[model samples]
Target: MSGKIRACYACQRNGRLTCRRTRLGEPCLKTYPLECVDLLKRSRVAFQAGRTLKEGFRLAQLEAVVQMLEEHECGFVDALGRDLHKSTTLDECLMVSEPLGVVFIMGNWCSPVQTCLVPLVGAIAAGNCAIISPSEYTAHTAELLHRLIPFYLDNECFHVILAGANDLPEVVELRFDHVFFTGNRKEGSRIARAAACTLTPVTLILGGKNPCYVDQHCDIAITAQRIAWARFHNAGQSLAAPDYILCHTDIQAQLVQALKCYLIEFYGSDPRESRSYGRMVNLEIFNRTRDMLWRSGKVAVGGQVIEAEKYIAPTILTEVVESDPIMQQDVFGPVVPVLTVNNMDEAIVFINKQEKPLCVYAFSKNNEVISRLMSETSSGSFCSNDSVLQSLMVALPFGGVGASGMGSYHGRYSFDTFSHRKSCLLRGTRFECVTYLRYPPYEDRNLSLMSWACTLSQRSQGWCQIL
Candidate 1:
């Protein structure tokens, strides 16, 4: 209505939204947050044009993501460090691979960049338009993505939505072709429910209290080092990180000592001062972790907390009962509780009693012990003699089961998650007369011939092996 202001003509004309903004004399530096309707319109238009159906286009977009990662590697690392107090020296990285049509991806603050972009890659590969709604908890990384994604990706097909609390209400109300979310069970359930309202299919990459079973036959030293590195690397904020340990009582004391030794070895005598050690992502997580730690159990190894710096030492709690506060829920922090079981059977029973986990890690030299656990468990994944290492293998699917979450993605799995698997069957029309053998009269000779035709035997043991 004034010289300083003008209605958002682009949104008004092309989208089901009315956005008014001021046209400053100079280049406007402010990012105008796209309305839910506007974001949907752009993606829908791209989807209808079949931009995603081109295999060449999908491959190019995938290449572009790799280029984006390589070109802006330092910037992403810096943002991760700023947001999660991540250690740059740590060489480990996590990614989830997938794609979908006019998709909405809601990432978590824990592994902000990886959780968001990995799925985006899958979506792109599957030839789907996407709107990435990054976690507000990691504001800096979100801001960087907002600026960088458009520069590398096809702007008409991809978008980064960054807005305040009020923006979310409108988002869940809009319908999407698919919704991919990664976060806690509570929030993940909420997102799934919201997606259901629109009759939209959803793939929830959720978190849970994954268990690590330490058998007496395990190489305690190696197990300890691996657990310490895996659990505390990202301040224990990883969804797949071992949440707690169920150790054989015979080796519980020694296992605790070994774990203590490794934590100090990996981080330092005081992890807070160690450059390799990480801190809590923010004050809210710090406080939640502190409370969980306080009520968890007696701190057997490290128990220091510096809330001001959002630091929680790589802490292990012993003398923890199965009914303890920390044991009952997912402890997504640098704090793990170790509980002792009389034997492998006790450990198995304890694990079976709880909700299915994302992963169940067992460390043992005994092949039988490993086999038993593998057969008995019902997790999305299980790793014997290792911890969360399978996630790095792009060939393997990364996801959870039951209460942990549903669906999976990584490499081919990611591509499949975003792409519909339509079954196609083709038959020769010239063979119509032959089909009458099994119809109408349905003679015993026709049945015999049909059965014989379908029957076959193995050519070799390679074709059919005894389990």
Candidate 2:
């Protein structure tokens, strides 16, 4: 039946499903492909049956998910490593996150497993049926999730569709309670538009060119190290990572030299040989990032690219102009650009002129400088004296604004996103004497009494205050 994927798990073979999406005999699917609208309809039926309404049911499902994570813990780590070159230390960020209802979660490439499981797990915790659409870009990790999730989760309430982003046009048009997505602004806009047809609520954790500002009065060495770590993490393909830097004219040269030293100390002379650094997830991303080299900025360090291995060294550019195309686009790779700003005002002006970012990083010992950025600009999240570290705090909500995204999740926010609060009232059967006073009366006394009863019951100096 088309309801369930009949494709063999070994060969990923199924003419019925593969024929519609991809060609024959090419390992067409890395995971089992199922119709998304069908799953949404099924989940809605389950929701209507009040199956997911109980807190016990919600916790049990979450426990089962925890069990799955425990059982296949190594598989997830191994798969992510193969896909993103993520190390054990770097893997901690993905482990943190939590969700929404009969929901569809569209995962992105940079942090594939985290993007998929975080939202799905949260939905289950909130007692909502969910169907996960892990990104096809991270094939190995997505395939592994395809195999494990069904065995661990309830198939009737929880589902995973092994398909590409292209498959979602049909899914979005259908009436879904909610949709949680994490990706680029272009795709996020499309998802919002599609979801709008049904007036379905959506949580989009989209990306943009997040700005990191370095002031003259701060410690350049520590600033350089932290910025390098944040920017180069996962080979600098992070949604919240600093896209470009604004340095005070006085400290520009010092910061660059400090960044240059940290690059060699952290990733070695040739970063390609380093295990901690990651490569491009796909050719399309690599092509986009590789083209940034053509712009008219000085590559301060690490500009090498190996097309065959999909590796780009941790590179930094200086003297970058606002007119450059790289400044306009989200450089979702390990490319960092530094532009000189006269002072805090110029940096704030530059940041405000662009679309609101997912996060803003400001490094300064001066509390006033930090406060100015915090108060003057708009972003999904803000951190003073740090870079992209705000996302690591599970207590804080993470999402974007403007071209970045809308809706937020993490901690209690995740539960609130998926759980629709039903305002309830309980009335007693013994109140007939008081209740009957307001029912179908044609007397002035009855009307007066009814009005008095509806008013706020209060006493002034032990006497009734009803007017």
TM-score of each: 0.72, 0.73
Q: Candidate 1: where are CA atoms >4 Å away?
A: 1-100, 163-170, 427-467
lDDT of 2 at 7: 43
The CA lDDT of each predicted structure is 0.80, 0.81
Following a full C-alpha superposition, what root-mean-square deviation does model 1 have from the true structure?
A: 26.1
Q: Specify the poorest-scoring 10-residue window by lDDT in model 2.
A: 87-96
Best by TM-score: 2
Candidate 2: where are CA atoms >4 Å away? 1-101, 428-467
* Per-residue lDDT of candidate 2, residues 341-459 (tens digit): 99899999999999999999999999999988987899999998888778867788888888889988887777777777653333445546545776774589777655644543322
Q: List the residue pairs that clash in candidate 2.
A: none
Please write out the lDDT profile of model 1 over residues 134-154, one tens digit for every residue. Answer: 889899999999999999999
